[model samples]
Target: MEYIHGRTGDQILGSTSIPAERKGVYQYMATAIQKLLRIPIPPELPPPPPPSALNNDVFRLVMFLDTEAPRIYQNADQLELHLNTIFITAHDICFTELLYLHMGSIYEQLKGLSNEPMVFCYGDIHPGNFIINDDGHITIIDFSETSILPSSFARYAIVSTSKLSRG
Candidate 1:
């Protein structure tokens, strides 16, 4: 990849000429995330969300999770518990707020959003990889580990790194 000319999202988001938060920067980050996931998946994803039928989006997500995530789910109750706890925690911390909530009941703060489907991810997302060019466009660098995987893994990467960043 050519050396992109611009400060990364991390640099611009920290102490610098530009303030950390901006509508344009967030917009670019969201768009860049979508584009990053569109990268080719090394392995084929599990079945695409079941197309028509009484199946809504949630059912398909559950189907995917039951297969890929921690192989600990036994019954529906067990699965629900695991999904509610781990997946919910990861998403709340990594995706929604862009900052992990370290207080009690953080998981409950985000209740009904555990159905994020699998997509090709950068496999490694951190402050540095998200780039913001001089032209106000964003890009996700590091295609080395990009592939189709559970969104939880990507979210986990963010949570892990953000903790380090916080420290």
Candidate 2:
């Protein structure tokens, strides 16, 4: 892995409590991920990787990062704390509920598009997975969770509730 000399979106958001600034960072992240999802999947490639493969890798990495991770969140409270620390640092309280609802909606939408075209997706697009370099450009770091999914699903994954402005 190449060394990245930069701060994570997590660290930058954590160091500030301003909602606008945080949202700006999230917008930047959304833009970067959208660009990534636009790359067309090669037609000659083999069958898409199974979702289980990505899940297993993520599980193993999380376990390696925190040995007690499995036992650490035994209930909703602990789970909430853990999520707050790692994932929802900048969003408001309602954002989590909205995120879940949006995810459910996207899942239902994608179900109807199983026969639609596919795209290359990052699979995981959280703040921690992105880095802000000294030049202010955002770089996506991890690709272990990358996969080919329905184009609509990939677009929803990045923009979530926001409408993407087309020029």
The best candidate in terms of TM-score: 2
lDDT of 1 by residue, 1-167 (tens): 58878877677666455544644555676677767556554332356622211122222221233323334332233443554565455663333332233222433433322354445544455557778877776667866545343454456544555466578
Worst 10 residues of 2 by lDDT: 54-63
TM-score of every candidate: 0.44, 0.53
Whole-structure CA lDDT of model 2: 0.52
Residues 1-167, candidate 2: write the lDDT tens digits: 78888888888888889998788678878788778767765544555533321122222111113312233333233433444444345443333433344346312211223344656656456778889877878888877656554454355445542432221
lDDT of 2 at 37: 64
What's the residue-level lDDT of 108 in candidate 1? 47
lDDT of each: 0.48, 0.52
CA shift of 16, model 1, Å:
1.2
